[model samples]
Target: MTEPVLCPADPAPVTLIGPPLAPGPLVFLGDHAGALIPRSLGTLGVGEADRRRHIALDIGIGQLGRLLAEHFGATFVSQTYSRLVVDCNRAPFSPGAMPEVSDGTAIPGNTDLAETVRADRVAAIHEPYHQAIADLLAGRRAAGLPTILVALHSFTPVYAGKARPWQAGVIHGGPGSDYGRRVLAGLQGVQDLTVGDNLPYAFDDTDYTIPRHAFPNALQWLEIEIRQDLLGTPDQVAEVARWLAPVLRDAMEG
Candidate 1:
């Protein structure tokens, strides 16, 4: 028998903030909101500095998601484990899901992992987080409520020594991303704000959450990425959230 990836004392794989409100069009997701590695993993052979970096999780997204959930009175579903353990946003079969190296940093514990060990992480963390999202969406559908899924994420200002120019990015593609395009256009119109229309990263086969949940339901969805530097402090996060709330609202009504 395999050892459990998460012990009873550990946090749940999924952290749900706010309750689902009927007829509410928003359901937010923070796939890399946390930086927790299971107690069993013991840091995955990563140093403290590296663990605090974007490779471990999406910086400031937890605060941002919570604030957004409060503002919109919508459910925010978030993953609690660090991406280094098992990237919830990547398919379990993808090598990038449990990377041996990320952005030049070596993950010694993940190097040459056994299939069973990998499966344990997938079953423990990846499955439950997504299942919660699916279950919520299903309940909303049964109640005849409309849903507009929004995936929140953050990226490092510089990747592999190259500086990223976009202050924020909106990713939209596939068959069900009409709403995403609208959001993208809306953000682009904002003065003095550099918004990327699928810049930093594009929505593609490598992505898991949005495609898995949104595509099948033909749901309106937007994957938004904010540069980590802009989200460093509490005031900055609040300011960004305040600025973005109207943009999302306008996109929905437009």
Candidate 2:
């Protein structure tokens, strides 16, 4: 049996914001918004430098998601724990969800983890964050409102010692690829940006959030990845948000 990873009074695994019934058709999610390890886990035995790396969180996505949500009055849901603890964007049972190593950095706490320990992280953090997304989407459906799910994320400017040139990526596959394409088209129109169709990474079975909530329901959706270097400052985040908000709005409207 999986032992309970959280004590009786841990903070909620998800942070839900914006009005539940916001007027827009958009719903935002930041699965890698936070980089906090539980007190009990104590940094998962990793160095401070690694803990603060892109493997821990999606860099500026939390603020970007919030700004988009606030701009559109859409519901925003984000995970509250670091992806190093348990990646909320990955399927609970997938290896990436509780990876022993990420982007070349080994996670000491995750090494040779017991099944129960892995299960506990899933139950404690991953499950609740996704459930909150489901609940919000269900409520929107119940209210007879249209929904367009947007999975917000950030990626390292360089990975595995290779420099990636794309400023951003729009990822989607299967029946949902059209919406992603529309978003990509809007982004491409921007001056001096090297946008990619699925550059940084593409969607696959390992992606839990969009596949679970957006794909099955036929909800129009897009999984967007912004370059982490572009989000190093609050002003930069705001600039990206400003640039993206209208593009998304235009895409959805068209």
Best by lDDT: 1
Encode model 2's per-residue lDDT on 175-200: one tens digit a residue.
76677788999999998989988888
Worst 10 residues of 1 by lDDT: 15-24
lDDT of model 1 at residue 218?
A: 90
Clashing pairs in 1: none
Candidate 1 lDDT over 1-254, as tens digits, reads 75688999999999989987545799999999999999889899999999999999999999999999999899999899999999999999689999999988999989999999999999999999999999999999988999999999999999888999999999998877888898888888888999998989998889999889998999999999999998999999998998888899888987
CA lDDT of every candidate: 0.92, 0.88
Question: Candidate 2: which stretches are off by over 4 Å?
Answer: 1-4
- Highest TM-score against the true fold, candidate: 1
Clashes of 2: 0
Whole-model lDDT for model 2 versus the true structure? 0.88
* Span of ten consecutive residues with least summed lDDT in model 2: 1-10
